[model samples]
Target: MRRSILSAVTISSLVFALGACTPKPDQADNAAESFLESLSSHAEPGEFTDNPDQAQEEINSSWDSLQAEGLNTSLNNVRTNGNVATADFTMDWDLPGDRNFQYQSQMTLTKTQDDWTVRWQPTVMHPDLGANQHLELRTVPAEMATVVGSDGAALLQPGTRYRVFVDTSTGDLQSTMRQVAIELDAMRANDESVPSIDAEAKAKEAEQVDGEFSLLTLNQQQGLDLKNRMSRVEGLRFNEEQAMVRPDPNFAPDIMSRVSSVVEKDLEGSNGWKVVAATSEGSEVRELGGQDAQTAPSVDVSLSKKVQDAAQAAVDTRSDAKVMMVVMQPSTGGILAVAQTQKADEDGDAALMGQYPPGSTFKILTAFAGMQNQGLTPDSIVGCPGTQDIGGRIVANYNNFSLGNTALENAFAKSCNTTFAQVSTDLQPGQLQQTAKQFGLGVDFNIEGLDTITGSVPRGDVMLERTEAGYGQGLDLASPFGMAMVASTAASGRMPTPYLIGGPEHRTEAQGEDGNQLPKEQLDNLRRIMRSVVTSGSGSGVASAGEVYAKTGEAEINGGSHSWLTGYRGDLAFATLIVLGGGSEHATSVTNTFFQNLDGK
Candidate 1:
């Protein structure tokens, strides 16, 4: 609002009116347009403005702070009142980055002696633009949205991460790395939520770098602890950044890290800009106009917080070995959880990509091959000898344990190596390989936001190789992810497509569209046999939890054996593995604890 104040003044000199005719309305409009053109060009308008020199000075002084690219003006309307006229015009300000600011304001023009001149005033720039004021553009960033899980629970939110690194100049690099891991572990024990690092890999990478190399990125509390504890350590540095992070540090840290890398750009929306009227002192007076930024949408993942916590806790029980467990929903093929202990993290997501001999778990495929090719049934009698020679290589049961002659179901439950070895030897090459793919093993899923490699089943013409492959001894390999798929196929009859992200554009599609489906009756019989393994055989450790179906295995490697268990209970199909964890009982115990914890919840 404009106000008028009364003040008494004495006239110093008398002025005489010029004998000139009033200019037309068109002349006023044209003069007003010329004045705007002068403002844009930062120059004085000749003979078109009452005070061109004063307007030129105001244009340069007021608009200098705007840093505008250019200005455009259009005359809206012009009203004539004898010698004085009002011209309403709109100004379009071209700003940086293809942005524009537009507003309507009015200017006055005086007519005398057949000439119309624009009368200068701050209001010509903007209606609310005050004296000694100019327009300034400022950009404001929008807030990132939360990343939710399948249950609509928050999985990740906007947060800060501090990357800590080490300089190789530090004395005794290996000893320093060991100490760093120890101190970091101590800090994590205090919070019980900090994510763990691959210390051995981090050390090896640092050794290859010249000056400094990053070790790990920690959440807020973890970073603060590092500063308080290790800031004084020589050759250590820290850098921080705003990032999307998991709320529960203990809930699938490594998996969530991978998720963040894929969804970060989508979560950060476009930035908004506004034009504000400011005084010469750069103090904002009022907002002229601007657009607001669109709200950024949240990301959704397939992880269940309750299930992930349970699996993570189950694996954390033993920190001695690299224990990993992958759980899947057979009905929808959603990845329920990918949990690994700190020791397992050192192997860089071995649960999804690491391949190892599956031991007796391979019997699942061998048994299916027998049923499909040899027309065998669960009630069919099979030989379970202590030791048997098939074409040259000798296949023996664990400690040469013999069950004599037994039903196929009982032999499967007992994980009879000799019996399955004989069954595999009977089938031709590529038969087991085809059966493996039918069970979702050895098939590439090409999942989005996640990289995975299913296990491998070889096609060899040699009888000994086929015999060893039957018991998962010679050239069979399966990752936890692949084994989990096998268990899912067993439960669902056909292999369900796996996906970590829920949206179709960011999801894992059905890559096995042309893959074979398991025979229903035979699969039912297999499921029954797998249940018996849990009911009265090798998987008895988890029998108390529920009607869990499973196959237990201990593949003998160089130093020790890899514990393996793959099966399903209800909608949850899973595979648990422990590298060099000795026996399948260790994997079974972990699975039991996982189920117990889940059921307890």
Candidate 2:
């Protein structure tokens, strides 16, 4: 009996000791990994959690409130104290706009029999969270800045807009056409820049369209007026919004379109955001983290509202031809205005982009080449015949005009085609093209907010082509913007880097770089030669507008001619073109009106 009792006691004691041994190291680690995986997956923490419902609720709430695109979690370090364990974990929340938020916190788990389960607690999600606390992400909007012009006045201002629409299939589309047309006509009358709409045409086009069709967008006051006018009109709808708009739509329409795209993002400043602890009602309970919104600064552009208005008015005077103009500040190379008549607008950005034969204007470059490469001065005598044969090509002045043997300045003023043709054909292959670059032609400018191409002068290796190019006909092509640069160069005696964005830091070098400044003696002589054109020659039409030094050109095409005038007065340099508008006098007349309008202001 004693022996049996001793054996039972010893076996029972041994079994008890084995049952109370320390837990396996991988036991708590596996449980922590399982809980983290569930939380990161936004799934229910079924077996690994003590209170599965609470754990699942908190996980889902956090994911939604934080607007997390994705969540990743990891088990950091675990410490076991008998049946209770503390596991350090990290949660990485991926937010919108490529933002990320990461935090390290501890989760509590208790061993129940053979299994370890996570405990339900707000601190398990975030160390800063309290009981019944919720997580939230908040955003603050930023105010956009206005674009200012050279006059330091708002050019493109932030304004309230309403994009008005109509469901063509919802109402009597055909019957309502007249009223809509009347309303649009009223808008046009109020703001002539507002495009005219054809209601009947729109109705006809919407015949097969069963969806919404946008009619027009109006400003706050204009929208109010429209609402009052179309209050009872069925199928009418509006989308309220904010955007940048030109106060005077007639002011440099082409340039405004180009500038809007480049400056749109820059106008909206930094937006503020915050992560906060909130209540069930979505109100802030405690501060978590975030940055305040920063207001965007004003954007200054290299344009003058006053100058633009004048230029637009001047260009509008011509309706029979496609007329365009580009004006720049000679001293700074800042664009002042771009203006185009109705016909020119139809051709798309011709004021700064249309490439055409530049006629007598090519003589300007040829004459410069003569001075720079051929040792010809303004006082040198050059021959001018009614018609001259060079390189087997016959070059003649307009109507075969002739000025037999005259001073270089006189020949230039008279626009003697033969004289310039001879000079151009006599030069080395690359001489003319190189000289053109010195005057801002044949180069490219990556001007912020402006898309422009300086004129092109091909290698004049072939004598016949060079002869024709010298007279501004054969392979020569230039836009109004290019000619403006040339005029500005002559005005300042060096090529000024042109820019649309005005600031100390935004200035940049133009493409196809080369020598910047030209010889002062030659430029001075060139200036004198240009002045003679206005005082007594082809450009005399604009002579009343002060000492307007200029060059007049008439490019001959198959059926007609293109008129051109490029020059400067005071600090304003400009170029004017009239497509198929015969005679340089028309261009000179247009230029005179532009200057006069500026003065009248």
Candidate 3:
């Protein structure tokens, strides 16, 4: 009876599979060519213009530039069968002067109007020369089974599981199979192993595979387990059928770099030297072999689409100069999007990566540290004259604002530099450094694609001079990224790890040699003080973000204009920097634009 049931089920499944097979290769190719033609119609011509002769010349110039390099590419054959245009080309492949054989590439070009373009293909360009030597242009079948969320988005959001299958026919195509295996091997080298679904084939093979053994499996045993797991679930099967589990390409690039970045930054000297691969989604590194996992995701702060629209509008309002804008999610440290006009080559990224003097923003850190070290509340009274001498240097309050004798909180609100400098005299040098370090100063928080500058702090007897450093003076240089770290640390009640990408859970196998965790009480102290700075401090000028904690700075760097605003909202921390290429108005206007757009989520 059992044998009868198994046979019946197997026969029924085979009949169904035969009926639902994917489209024929020729049909798939036709569909892909048609899609490419449609895409070419909207392809923006890139840098191409109305002048046909100029466009052709530009293409020749681009090719000439490639020829100047050691690698050579020549078009040998071109054939068009309907929309499918195939081009065979050879490249003179010589690596580091050794004579290597030229390779042939078969390219399918979809003709849209007069120009034949390679579409939906991986364009391989030599890294040093920046020349496209070959392209394997093929249409990805529309029926290709892909995992999507309930809403049909990519399987990127949380709680989404993907299906995996191994195509037995792939083994027959040696070149394609080997290439696929190589790519998968490179991906699995990362600590965050993407799970695979080819267990059944593995059980029969005698030789060991190169990639993540823990992830891939054979079809019989593992496939049965996986199939059973999926069969038990309702609505989890592919909308079609026989969809194989492959690493989604979109996530592959991010996952490949995610772990490596962490190992490069945090674990550099020790076992990091031995690390073959690492994974970092922006900043948080997924350590392999049970190493220390990141406590938080890296900060990804970019303009939302709505804000980008607003920023474009703002740029349109201006004609002569460029407009640069940045938007950041204070919570989770994720940069949403970065948008800018063509005029500004730098973009408002200078606001984040550019280093500048802190000016008065330093007062917030100073006052917080002084108050904390002295065991003095914000209301603790301190005297302030128009000017005071500290470490043989005379410091005057901003605009010489004198509060006579007043509480520290009132002094802070008034932006009285004299009171702050005097208060700094009480705290030792070690105390101030410790305070700054807590705010992620003087330490590298690895942000991919951006350079970070750790603002300066005095080494020794500058403790008297250190008071001025508190008021955004005396060698304190910081980037927008650094300030955001300070604010996020203040907001999260701990330093939340800043990152750009998310997902693929981090597994910590073991703690590092330094076994360090951000102390709870220290984070609390930062929160309390930073909260006060926003509610009733000099930063109140920019406190329109509704119950936000912030600090503002206007630094004088010789002749350059640098203004700063750093703040935190809930778990989100951000810093906005405005640098004036001309004057202070540049800084102030940028700041105003930033605050004007700060409608928090």
Give residue 254's lDDT in candidate 3 (0 to 100).
29
Q: Which tens-of-lDDT digit does each residue in 271-342 have in candidate 2?
A: 988888887778788877776889789988989998888887887889778998899998888899888889
Model 2 lDDT on a 0 to 1 scale: 0.83
Which 10-residue window of candidate 3 scores lowest in summed lDDT?
4-13
lDDT by residue (tens digit), candidate 3, 1-601: 1111010000011111344566433332343333223222322222222333433343333223222223344545555587666655554422221323344544455655654455322222222122222211111122222232212334221122333333433233233234334444544455234334233444334134332222233222334444454453322222222322323332223222443343233222222111111111112122111122222222222224344444344433433454333434545555432333445444534544556677766666676677567776666778888888877888887577677998766676556778877777678776766666666665555554334354655642666567767677777777666666666656654444544433323221211112134455544554555566657765655455556676666676676556556665554455555454343234334444544554532
Per-residue CA lDDT of candidate 1, range 1-601, in tens?
2112112111122233546774333566566666766665655553456666666665665555556766766666777798899978777777777777877889889988988887776777788877777777877677887889876779999889898878887776776677678887888777777656666777888899998988888887788788778766788887888877677876777678788888777788878878888877778888778878765878778888878888888998988779999999898888989998888888887999999999988899999899999998999999999998788788889999999999999999989999999999999998998898888888888777788988898895887778889988888999999999999989888888888876767856555434457778888888989999998889999988888989999898898899999999999999999998888999999999999889894
Location of the lowest summed lDDT over 10 successive residues in candidate 2: 5-14
Per-candidate alpha-carbon RMSD to the true structure: 8.5, 10.2, 28.0
The reply for model 1, stretches above 4 Å from the true place, is 1-27, 40-70, 96-98, 111-116, 161-218, 222-241, 399-405, 445-451, 501-516, 558-560
Q: Relative to the true structure, how large is the alpha-carbon lDDT of every model? A: 0.82, 0.83, 0.46
Runs of candidate 2 with Cα error greater than 4 angstroms are 1-138, 167-169, 173-182, 195-216, 273-292, 399-401, 448-450, 502-511
TM-score (C-alpha, index-matched) for candidate 3: 0.46
Better of 2 and 3 by TM-score: 2
